[model samples]
Target: MSNYSIKAISNASNDAIIQLKELNISFGITEKTSETLPNPAELFLGSFAACILKNVERFSGLMQFGYKKAELLVNAVRLENPPRMDELTYELTIYTQDEKLNSTLLKKNIEKFGTIYNTVKQTCKISGNIIVHKNV
Candidate 1:
């Protein structure tokens, strides 16, 4: 089993910071949350986004495909009563001229193999589509 650990510290009046690896991320906490720093919910969604992107890079070599770049847009809705995210949608745009890239297969691989995507989709509704733009 893989293991991971991080540390976070904050005062009641100041923003919290999480020491992850060699990087320090300062984020909002309680009333300290603002537009400047990402809140917990946004961070959660960011993790999901990162997982998807990471898998894309991993699958590129496995599937024998090359791409110029990939862009993803994620949208989420939070339910106030239970105070949780209820829905998430994503649009992935891949810029590539590779004929080996299969959109359907790639989507299935992401949904099945992604760690964070599976975790969030267990309780939250997730719907998305992949669009491929060919280069001329």
Candidate 2:
């Protein structure tokens, strides 16, 4: 993974391309990206969740913490009049007993450092909490 910090997660959104070095992922995105892909809202929700998960790996290294795994469940509310995602909530579970793991700091970093999270929060109401499981 790339080195990332609360201040170092400095990339702005709206680019057509994304690359994940560790995962060997490099793809260019476009409007109506792929017919095989899920609908826009579903894709957005996946992106939202992905951002959080990515940040967990990110902050874990930057913050010097360890975790076995992390899981996230994201739920959204749809508005039909204009067709939009109005609200988003997430349940994030991090399985770790690292003494250095700080939930409060982690949550704040994830929220502030996330690309999709920041973009979505600009227009939608977002609320979520991080659950740290010490013995898993």
Candidate 3:
């Protein structure tokens, strides 16, 4: 098994920074909120979306498919009583000439192979649909 780790440091305020290699991401700690930085919940949802997109690119190469571009939108529903994500929904749009032929297969591979996707699906209700737009 391979082990991965990230480093995070926080000051006295409600702000923290996470480091992964050369990347640095700032997040808010307290409920006070900040327009510049994401909160913990937002970061969680964003990580899910990022994982799906990364897999989309990986599967495209492995399956020998081509696409002009891809876009993803994600939303999460939080339960008030428990204060946790109850459900998550995502919409992925892929711009490619071969629309109907490969969309389903690509979507299947992403759900099957994505690490974060599978992990999140275990605890929260995850659902999404893919839209293939044939590039002109």
Name the best candidate (by lDDT).
1
Write model 2 residue lDDT over 1-136, tens digit each, in one string: 5654221121243223233444322222434445443444675788899899999999999999999999999999999999888999999999988889999999999989898899899999999999989996
Query: Where's the lowest-lDDT run of ten residues in candidate 1?
Result: 27-36
Each prediction's TM-score against the native?
A: 0.94, 0.72, 0.91
lDDT of 3 by residue, 1-136 (tens): 6689999999886689999999999898866666767988899998998999999889888888888888999999999987899999999998888543488888899899999999998998999999988763
Q: Which stretches of candidate 3 lie over 4 Å from their true place?
A: 31-33, 99-101
TM-score of 3: 0.91
lDDT-better candidate, 2 vs 3: 3
Decreasing lDDT order of the candidates = 1, 3, 2
lDDT of 3: 0.88
| Candidate 1 residue lDDT tens string, 99-130 | 99998999999999999999999999999999
- Over all chains combined, what TM-score does candidate 1 have? 0.94
TM-score for candidate 2, please give it: 0.72
Error of 3 at 120 (Å): 0.6
